[model samples]
Target: MRPLRNIFAAILLLSGAALWATARADDGAGRTPTPHPPRAQGEHCVADTDFMRRNHMKMMMAHRQDVLHEGVRTPQFNISGCVNCHAVKGDDGKPVSFASPQHFCRSCHTYAAVKIDCFECHNSRPETDGKAAATEIDGEDAARLAAFLRETKQ
Candidate 1:
């Protein structure tokens, strides 16, 4: 009876191993793996010119101190605002994007001696989708946004 029990235990162990191997094989064979898609043209959902005009100052203010630091802390804000504009389709055929204070904000900020550490957390290129571009903003809309930024500064 003891010998029979040992045989049963061995059989159970073998069955488990076999099942695991079969599952792995099945997983591999279940579907044809998709190839990575190509990089999309343009800067994703960002409004190239308007985005540059608006929010540049606010972003600069947020990163000014960090830019001066040799070892800066990770920024408190994520790229959501910038991503709202810069979001683009990714190489994997999914939405991907980034927003760097340096890329969008540095030109103006540097003129004012505001050092920006844009590379710390933000990538030079952000991914985005067309959702951000669907909004119909006129010149007045851009001007208003710019005015709001100016108000924030004061």
Candidate 2:
């Protein structure tokens, strides 16, 4: 009877250890630790750090249609706003572009295994203040577009 009692006690101890281990594992799975946001040279963000960390994607998505379709550009949601602040300078003092992992966006995106397509169509660096708005459509294309619009109106 004493041996039986000892066996039962051993089993209980093992079961408790197993339960503790399982609970600890489940806690981790529920919220895997995220990598810390990279420190940029800029001290402040457009939004609070916590808010930006959580909902930046949603903010950018909403701003895209507003800016692109409506031509309503605002400082707060401009992609250049982010680049101007977040871009890390290279050895030459020019910014490292989004293609590099050292870039603020790429660092987090790479850690999360997320691929962003924004840079494919947009400039990765902040545009120079002296530079005029450069359009991809050249003079011939502009004239052709004007002619098409005129012909369609008639």
Candidate 3:
């Protein structure tokens, strides 16, 4: 009986050691690298990479408040600049919209499990020939929207 108990204890210790080694091996073996989203197309960002990563939201919000409430617009901290510079190309060889996960903003936001509402009122894709597509509203769609608004008013 004593010999049997000793053997059982040795087997348990060896199994645990084997399991720990397997886990340690897995920690560095064939692990997928962390996702590194593309950065600005320009030579430099508006701010340093570390600073931008930490405080970009604050900067953009302050800029938004200034632009909307004070009528002050500057190139620094402009959201449009960020969108244009960080635009990622899709399979069609055109810039992807916010709907695509490959879009510059979506890559990090999806990884962080963060919801992005900025694109709700802002264009996710860069303009072509320096013209914005947001300025246009189809006549038929406009009429439908107007009708819907009038019905809801009643």
Candidate 4:
């Protein structure tokens, strides 16, 4: 009976080791995905690539506060400028919306598993008339959107 117990314990130990090795191999098997955002229409970005990569969120949030609270809008660090310059065109030659994986913002945000609400209030595609598009949510829809956002926050 003691020998049988030892054998069962060895089997469990071996099985656990095998499972751990398999899981470790699986975890390291794939190459990490890197984002290759679409090229800008202009020759240069407002800032260099490295700087933008590291600080764009900070700059954009500051810019948003300036625009919304202070009535100050600058061409530099403007999100509309970003959408216009970095617009990724679809097969139809129209700018792709955020729903498309090829959308400029999604290229990085999706790769990072980051959820952005910026597009919920702002247009993902370039503006046709050089004006920010305004989308009005009705009472029921607004409530639903609010609930959805609350759920996603968790």
Specify the highest-lDDT model's number.
4
Candidate 2: regions farther than 4 A off: 1-36, 128-154
Candidate 4, residue 81: the lDDT equals 89
Each prediction's whole-model lDDT (CA)? 0.47, 0.69, 0.75, 0.80
Predicted candidate 1 versus true structure: per-residue lDDT over 1-154, tens digit per residue: 9999999999999999999989978786544342322333445533344573566556556665565564464533344455333344444653332121223343344345444454335443443343333233346444653553454353
User: TM-score for each prediction?
Assistant: 0.23, 0.58, 0.68, 0.66
Q: Model 2 scores what on Cα lDDT?
A: 0.69
TM-score of 2: 0.58
- Candidate 4 lDDT over 1-154, as tens digits, reads 9999999999999999999989977776545567888789999999999999999999999999999999998989888889989999888787776666677987897677677889777877787786654445456545655654554463
After TM-score superposition, what is the CA distance of residue 25 in candidate 4 from its true location, in Å? 13
Instruction: Write one digit per residue (lDDT tens) for candidate 2, span 49-133.
Output: 8898889999999899899899988888888778767767666776656544456776677567666767657756655575522
Q: Which ten residues in a row have the lowest lDDT in candidate 2?
A: 132-141
Model 4 clash pairs?
none
RMSD of each: 16.2, 12.6, 8.7, 6.1
Evaluate candidate 2 by giving its C-alpha RMSD to the native, one decimal: 12.6
Tell me how far the alpha carbon of residue 128 in candidate 4 is from the true structure, in angstroms, after superposition.
Answer: 2.6
Model 1 lDDT, full chain set:
0.47
Q: Please give the lDDT score at residue 140 for candidate 4.
A: 50
User: For model 2, which pairs clash?
Assistant: none
